[model samples]
Target: MTNPTLALTLGDVAGIGPEITAKALLAHPELREIARPVVIGDADAMRRGMRATGFDTDALVVIEDPREARNDPDTVELVQTGPSLADVPIGELSAAAGDGAYRFVVEACSLVRAGRADAIVTAPLNKAAMHAGGHDFAGHTELLAHEFGVKDYSLVLSAGDLYVFHLTTHVSLRRAIEDVTVERTTQVLNLAHGLARALGRPEERIAVAGLNPHAGENRLFGDEDADVLTPAIEAARERGIPVDGPIPADALFPAAMRRGRWNLLVACYHDQGHAPFKSVYGDDGVNITVGLPAVRVSVDHGTAFDIAGTGQANEASMVLSCVRAAELAPGWGAVVDALS
Candidate 1:
């Protein structure tokens, strides 16, 4: 089979997305061996990024189709998507930059749906800028879900063999607690298992972290773990999915990281998973949305406005996102089937 085609979306033009994309492609020479990356965004913004990041501008070649991409390590193939964003003011927010970011994703989704691309590896997009652009979505996961009309989705953060799936994200703590019902917990557990199976580890155990401290200390602190999370784990076990927990977050995360007890984990909310994962993995992790028709991977970090134009941003996560996208693209059909 030919190499998978990755539609790499350059997120918020004003932030570090463009700079990181340029840097990642240049920094990781092996990317050409795994996939053909076609950049989807404004050409002007990309040129500005190339110049700012000290990459040769002559390497950028704008093409109308993904099939036209040459997959050359020195060449950055771009499919210009939105309006010119070269003057959108790096290190600041602009409606034009926001709209351009939004448009790039839309175009990438269109490419995937049309079978022009096998997967998407996205750079960071500013949520505030996205809202300012009049497209109000929580983030890339939610936007991609909306574009694909998928409601049963979860934000999965992965670093190598470790995968953490969030039950609720981008919601207030109170709302998150309210939203952590048995149904949702079970859904996320199954999604986590689906991912494990997709990754060719169907027999690996899945761990569920508790919503309360010490997993509620057997009902001393809170009852969400006993009442909600436990039942979800039990039900998932009944379905013949190798599952464990309502384990305390503190113990579960440490064991997953150090001892290799479980490869798959279900986080109660965003920070429950994000904090420790980011702390340990840093630029090694990539965000994945399970239940989408096509594989979508993104840098776990956000658009860093403070270092936008300095060309000093680390492209590790961006490169990892692309690498993970290439790894997932081949078995993505199994992923789609398992999640659906």
Candidate 2:
């Protein structure tokens, strides 16, 4: 089988999305071997990114159709998904930049749904800018769910040996805890299990982190562990899912990282998982959305507005995002064979 077409979306013009994307494509020539990568964003912003990164190669080409891509290392194809952003200022959020980023994602998703692209790799987008531009969603996760009309989905972050799935994302800590019912936690666990399997893991162990310190210490702290977490874990196991805990938040992560005991950790809230995973992976992680209609992967880091136009951004995460997306494709093994 020929290489699958991987669609890339330029996140926010005011941030490091363009720079990192250009650098990733230029630095990793092997990307063209496994799939024809078609970039979806403003052409002008990409050009600026290419020049900023000193990637003076004819390998980059702009195409109108994803299928027309030739998978040539000498040509990274660009597909304009939004209007020209040549006048948009760098290092500063603007409605235009936010709209452009939103449109790019919408177009990329459309391609995947239409079967023109086999998978998607997204850069970072500024939430404030996205909201200012009239897109009222928390982040890419919500945007994707809304667009696809998917009722159930979860975010999984993979960094080297660590895998974390959040029980709640983009919400206040109080709201996060309130959202963690038995049903929601079980659903997240099931999604994590499916994602692990997709990534070649086989019914591996799962660890669920507690909502409170020391896992409620037998209700000395909170009833969430005893009342909510324990039942959820039991339900999962009863359904033939291998899982453990309501484990103490403080002890679970270190143990998982040190012993590799669990295939994935289900955190009760955002910071509970992200703080530990980011501490280990830093900026070298990929965020994957499970239960989507199409394979979608993104850099775990965000649009660093602080270093937007300075050419100081790292492309490692973005490159890994593309690699991860390729790995999750429907016929990824065949693509790997073609690469070999």
Candidate 3:
């Protein structure tokens, strides 16, 4: 099989997306060997970022086809998605930057749908700027699901060795609690299993975290653990899925991540999973959208508006995003086979 073409969408130009992306491409030596990396953003912005981040390259190779990308150490191929943004200032939000970011994602999706690219890795985008520019989406996960018409989807975050999927994301705390149901939990568990399989762990085990403190303290606080969670676990087990839970959130993380335990954790809400995952992985985590028709992974962090254009943002998360994208591609087995 040919090398999988991984298309990267520069998040928000005004933020650190371009800078960190260029840095990741330059620092990772093995990445250029496994998959043909292609950037779907403004060429000029990428060049500016390369210069700003002090990443020296041989030349800017433009390509019309993903198969034409040269898998050389000094060569980085780019497919221009939007017009030149040479005049757009850094560190300030503008409609042009928002439009450019949106166009990059749409173009990447087109490439993936057309079979030109195997998977997509995205940088961070500012929600406020995107809304102001008429994009009107909460985040990348929602946008991708809408574009592909995928109904069963979950946001899975990988921090170090810990993988977590939330029952609800990008909503208020009260709304997230209210949204918890047996059906939703089961759907998330199934998605988690699929994601684990894609990551080369087909028989991965999953543990579900409870909603309330002490797992509702035996229904003294709330009945969510017994009513919603216990039934979901039982239903999944009936289907032959290896799942265990309604475990207390406090004890779940340590037990799952201890040594040889479960491969994934399904959190009842957002913070219950994220807080522990981020604590271990720091900026090395990647947020992947599971159950989509196409492969899409993103940096777990958001646009650092305060430090925009400062060249201080770390690219570890973006680098991990690329690695995860390569792993999910259909031709990923070739890359892994060659490495092994």
| Residue 109, model 3, lDDT | 87
For residues 29-111, could you state the per-residue lDDT of candidate 1 as single tens digits? 89999889999998888888888899989989999999988888998899989667767998898878888888999999999
For all predicted structures, in order, the TM-scores are 0.97, 0.93, 0.89
The alpha-carbon deviation from the true structure for residue 241 of candidate 3, after best TM-score superposition, in angstroms, is: 1.9
Query: Where does the lowest 10-residue lDDT sum fall in candidate 3?
Result: 331-340
Model 2 lDDT tens row, 99-126: 8888988999899789899888999998
Pick out the ten consecutive residues of candidate 1 with the lowest summed lDDT.
Answer: 80-89
Best by TM-score: 1
Clashing pairs in 1: none
lDDT for 185 in candidate 1 is: 87
Of candidates 3 and 1, the better by lDDT:
1
How many clashes in each candidate?
A: 0, 2, 0
Off by over 4 Å in 3: 56-58, 159-161, 196-203, 258-260, 331-340
| Candidate 2 similarity to native, TM-score | 0.93
lDDT of 3 by residue, 95-171 (tens): 88888888888888889889888888998887777777789777788888888777788888876556788899878
Off by over 4 Å in 1: none
When superposed on Cα atoms, how far off is each prediction in RMSD? 1.2, 3.8, 3.8
Q: In candidate 3, residue 105 scores what lDDT?
A: 87
